[model samples]
Target: MSRHEALNPDDHRDLRIQERRDAALGDARMVCIVVPAEFRALQAEYPILFRLNETRDRFSALAMFGFENGENLYLADGRWDARYRPLAIDIQPFLIGGRPDEDGPKQIHVDVDSPRIATGDEGVRVFDKHGRPTPYLERVIEQIGELDHGFRESGDFFAALQRHELLEPFTLEVTLEDRSDNRLVGYHIIDEARLNSLSGTALAELQAAGHLEPIYMAMASLSQFSALIARRNRRAARG
Candidate 1:
């Protein structure tokens, strides 16, 4: 139930997008799609995980927002608490659309139904009076491009992981402050043990091929779950 349309600067010049976080503004996502380019930044703030998309037939990188579905711990009081907000969330209602013309450049489409978009001036401006994309919109366009490249690279990265037999199933078992167990399953994480067991030549090749750093980043991100658990405990205490 999304109303998406190819953004026309002329017609949508007056459109606005709120800068703050709000579940009602379509930011209530438990997981946000991330490209390999964001792994370093997001790893510091979130536990990066790989998710399979059956329809796309591709493995995608995701930033874990909360331990449970439909829960975004980063979103509290209409503000994003994380210092590093993933570009996937920043892109908002704007998504990549097919080419505007047969051989012309691709178009950025916006969802009119998204609560982020409005007629009144409140947050980020989509266009200026001259009918040109505003600076904020321009940055969003750039991020969309970054995401596109990241997706392509991620496919190859995942393939490398598969080839090395490094993708392993992970089940996170956490005992909250209430002594209730929260078991998160059905996701994959880098197998640090297996990765460390690789031969020197293989390790060299993987590093030269630009896969080693991200692997370690993923391994390091697991510790962030402590922060996630703390947030969950706080939420429970509130209730």
Candidate 2:
């Protein structure tokens, strides 16, 4: 007689969206890390690195990160298989060129990649096209370029938030797939604020530094939100 164990199909089958809800939760947080203008020196010490432009005023570096899942994914270089490269040097006046801004980072057409594990800053992860967490850091650096320019132009680092919706209302969205069939099995949307509260320590550290901290939830009160809109309108009218 062949000895075969009777299996509970549901136990081994693909997870339903609700089945993973208890174990899988959506979460997101923002941090402001200071990178010195002379950041190239630190590259050799880490798994990543960069080379500077001729003027020495600017440099480029890689942005991959080690994630909880152990999968290190960078922006999918659709044209090239290369996963890690100096984002600044590789992407430039043509690929990421944007309308010039005196204060903000130059706007560029950088594709958003899925999040993955990061290398530094234990527990710090980045969001990608799908809102899933990953260790990818290049996207953040790209944002930094934009933020630097935006702040210089509009005098507010969060101007991108008001200009773009995809970047705002930050949240974590989980999408699970069956490896065999590549079918989506589960999904979840984690509120950024909920993640912020849970990551009080990380948020506190960012605040301690003089960085334009990101508030997961834009307005703590409705009146405040309204006031901001009124101010924006008034400023636009003056201009």
Which candidate has the highest TM-score of all?
Answer: 1
Candidate 1 residues 1-239, lDDT tens each? 79999999777878998888898888877888787768788888999988766796656778898877788988888899998898878898888786311233567889898888765667878889899888999899898887766665676688888889887888889999988888888788888889988999989988898988888888888889999889989988988
Please give the lDDT score at residue 153 for candidate 1.
69
Off by over 4 Å in 2: 1-85, 89-96, 99-101, 104-106, 111-239
Taken over the whole model, the C-alpha lDDT of each candidate is 0.83, 0.28
lDDT of 2: 0.28
TM of each candidate vs. truth: 0.92, 0.18
**Top candidate (lDDT):** 1
Instruction: Score candidate 1 by lDDT.
Output: 0.83
Tens-digit lDDT string for candidate 2 (122-207): 33333434544233335454544644543343323222222221122222222222211111112111234444444566445435
